[model samples]
Target chain A: MKLTNSMEGVTIVETEDIKAKKPVVLCGLPDIGLIGIIAVSHIIKELNMKEVGYVDSDIFPLIVVFHHGEPTYPVRVYQKDNLLAIFAETALSPESVHPLSKVIVGWAKEKNSSLLVSLGGIGVPNRIDIDTPRVYGASNSASLRESIKKYEIPVMEEGFLVGPYALMAKLSMHSDLPNLLLMAESYPQYPDPGAAAAVISALNKFVPVNVDTKSLIQKSEEIRLNARELMRKTSENMQKMGKSQEYELPLMYV
Target chain B: MPAQKRMPIEPADTWSYGVMWDHISGCLEPLTEFHDKETELMIRIDMPCVKRKADVEVNLTEDTVAIEAKMNRVVQYEKWGTFQREAKFFRYSKMFTLPAKIDPDHSKARFKDGILELHLPKKERRYSVKVE
Candidate 1:
């Protein structure tokens, strides 16, 4: 935990306890709202990256220098305009997407990321809010689409995206850096183990991990039941409308 | 006494009995206003995990607008008090009051990326004739 005189309250986050590897994948999202935060944490644990020093937000240009052991690949930290940006061969944890996706994508392109995939979720109505969640995928890059298509993950045909997902799409387009977004339907505004399980499934196809999803399934009911009351209000808000439901493959458990 | 700013209309307590517990609450920051010659309203919502457009649902009324967006389920690591789904969201639901009557059939909505935008057109106003 290091503070810098560069800027005011910007705290840079990196990790230790990792396996050095290349072609690293990084994730971010809209805000502390989506489960990207959790995805990143799992990525950190799955990949096991050594923690470098903190990069103060005040620093110009995204530069992540480890005060300790040198990282496998160079990581940079700074801001892209007002958004907080970080670039590393290593990915961050908790995968929380923030408004800074625009910033981070730029950093990824600079590092010439072979591929960048941002994982996130959406809350739905008219469903059981089950433990086994399904996932969908989208890509601004054709290669990404081709690789992910074998999994039979649905492609995003339409819709609006904001914050990190939106920015990541835009930056990748501008830089010609291929980016894909894998989203799973989750409980609105509450933690969802089911959605996380779906992400882990998709990531496993690419990131290569040894973690077991069986453990996460147990947390499904725990998290789903945990938010029953608040979900009731959301239910009331949704009842005014009527429509059919959508489905994804099982990611968590029955 | 100092005057404090007033917040927009709060979500009604007894919302439709539907299973609304899926969505978190007011996460996507809404826009300041949506206006056309016929109608105008303010909307801002956050749907963190939506990968494609087919995952959301929207409905509108003369005085109300209800939205249901499916959040991609991602577990957040730490308890940050407000967020749960991977810290992005569980779901997002918000209702709005229209300044004028709206034609639900004539309105339009678009969700690109993860944000959902709704365009509601106002119903024509009828002048009341007073007989003296």
Candidate 2:
């Protein structure tokens, strides 16, 4: 519970000492369709990961997530072996996206992580018609782009990505950090466990987590029902951040 | 100084799934989005666990739309948040007030993959004039 406030507006509280050989840093902030939150949460539970640290900031909503009887930070860091996952249980405001992304990238660099992966969703209006949600990959460096190609994943060649993942990618690039963004086609304002499962399946190809997605698919309805509130709040924040820009074609591309 | 008539400002409906008592009421409010298009107001509601279109009921007025949907089965949660008690919900209900007047008679709706989309055309059409 030792909260160390940083000038970046994010306070990281490390409850346990973490030691690993080039761990992979995964971020699952509340974004479109709650894809990151659902995907990372499922991975955390399935892997039985332990909470190592938590991030707090004034820009974040004043709320505490209660699990069982213990009060937990809304944004927490969980780790198992060499894999570290940072996820938020609540929606984040637009103003917090930049500072939080910078803090996370800086922390990941300090930890000497091998790769930073961001799980998210690309909002598609026709997501209802889509059965198998497609995952698109975007990278910060050429090496990561080559890694994405090795997996046969479609590269996001042209589009504007907004929100936390967008900020994370930009900051990671500036820091010379290898960052990977996996986004699935998802409803803009609904909790999409289906899309999360698709992303997790793609992630297992590279990360080797080997998590069974059958349970995730089976419990999709329940997750959607339970996550309605967070999805609503996240959708509002997405609108404020001009997330619709992602759909518009960039003039530079033309 | 003339006293101006005050137009009523409708409060936006906030839906959340964090309430433990939401299930006890036998109904849960689904998350909804209302978009004001150029010619129509599009309303989308997330109503998962609904098996078929027959399970959903939508009622629309000039400025308000009400939705009630029955879940295929009782959704039970063993422990929600810090609450240790079990909770069960069987239905989803919500009402949305649009910003502009709509033609309820011309409104059309479609339900697919647990999402209900409503297209309500505006009663009055908007016109643009070209600059000379």
- TM of each candidate vs. truth: 0.45, 0.87
Q: Point to the candidate with the largest lDDT.
A: 2
Question: A1-254 in candidate 2: lDDT tens per residue?
Answer: 55533536787777888787899998899998899999999999999999999999988899987776678899999999999999999989988888888888888888888889999998887787899999999998898789889988899999899988898899888988889899999888889999999999989977999898899989998899889878877888988999989889888834
What residue pairs are clashing in model 2?
A: none
Candidate 1: interface RMSD in Å? 10.4
C-alpha lDDT of residue A212 in model 1: 67
Worst window of 10 by summed lDDT in candidate 2 chain A: A1-10
The DockQ-based CAPRI class assigned to model 1 is incorrect
**Candidate 2 total steric clashes:** 0
Which DockQ-derived CAPRI band holds candidate 2? medium
- For TM-score, the strongest prediction is 2
* Per-residue lDDT of candidate 1, residues A4-102 (tens digit): 212133343443222222234456332212345445544454444334433333332343434334433233332221212233322222122232354
